[model samples]
Target: MFYTLVKIIHLLCACVVIGYLIYDVFIFSHFKKNRSEVEFIKLKRELLKPSALILGLAFLLLLCSGAYLASFYLGGELGWLESSFQQILVLKISVVGLLFVFTPISFFYILVLKKSDPMRKFYHHLALLICLIALIFAKLMFLF
Candidate 1:
């Protein structure tokens, strides 16, 4: 029961981060050019803090819960790390680790750099790609 609950929380956290990354990369970018500079700047300023909070918190929770769940699979008589499924989990965790590094850099660009810079969009797409890779590994972990 406790494991099930943690799995649910982990899944929910993944959904939150993935959904937000999708929104940031696809929907937000599409809408960005439609607005005038002044309006867009105002909107960006308003949305930045809250979006950061949501994404950061969700990603943190996801990593924490993932670590908790992964503990069930590590270092046993059968040697969990030697299995293909656990290997895929390690890959997923590694990819997520890259996201952990990139996220702060992206946030720094968005917050400290000029709002109109193109790097923000680049970072968003990069994050989306990373998340997709992790998602793929997740499926593979279950399959094999």
Candidate 2:
């Protein structure tokens, strides 16, 4: 029962995180390119706060539930270090860790750095790309 609950939360959070990431990469990028400062600021005020809050909550839920699932289902008894599943899991975790680093940098760029700064755009796009890759690896890990 406990495991089932954790699994549900993990999957739900993953969906939320992935959905937001896709929007950030696709829709938000386009908006950033075409929108004026006032438009962008308005959109950011309307969208970013809620999105960021949801994303943060989703990430936290994912971390907690994922840790529980990993330790409960895949660690110790599974001899995870010796298994392909474990390798894939490790890769997924590493990518997530990279996102942990990239996410804050991207957020700060958006919240603090002026929009005209070229590096802000670069870091945002880079973070999205990394997130997309991480999402792909997560799916692949499940299949493996």
Candidate 3:
């Protein structure tokens, strides 16, 4: 029961993170082209605060719950270093770690600095790619 609850939390948080990234990369980005720069900037400023808050919270929850979930697979006869599942999990965690770094940089570049660089878009795409890879590793964890 406890494991199931934690798993559910982890799943929900993953959905939140992926959903936010999709919105950020696909939908919100395209709005810039339709609106005037000033209007877009204003809209971005208004939306970024709440979006950032929710995303940050979801990430924190996801990380905590993921660590808990990973603990279950670590305590078998095979040492974590020797287990294929653990190896894949380590790779997933490493990829997810990149998002921890990327998220702050993306937020700072947009919210604090208030500069819209083309490179920022690249970072978003990269993050989305990273998340997809992590999701793939998640599935591979059970298969291996």
Best model per lDDT? 3
48 Cα displacement, candidate 3 (Å): 3.9
Residues 21-54, model 2: lDDT tens digits: 6776688868878999889879977988867888
lDDT of 2: 0.74
Model 1 Cα lDDT, one tens digit per residue, 38-129? 88778876877677887788888888889999888776665767999888888888887876676566667678973554555476687789
What residue pairs are clashing in model 3?
none
**Relative to the true structure, how large is the alpha-carbon lDDT of every model?**
0.81, 0.74, 0.85
How much lDDT does candidate 3 score? 0.85
- Cα lDDT, model 1, residue 31: 60
Model 3 Cα shift for residue 129 (angstroms) = 1.2
Candidate 1 vs candidate 2: the lDDT winner is 1
Q: Count clashing residue pairs per candidate.
A: 0, 0, 0
Model 2 lDDT at residue 93: 73
Off by over 4 Å in 3: 75-78, 103-118
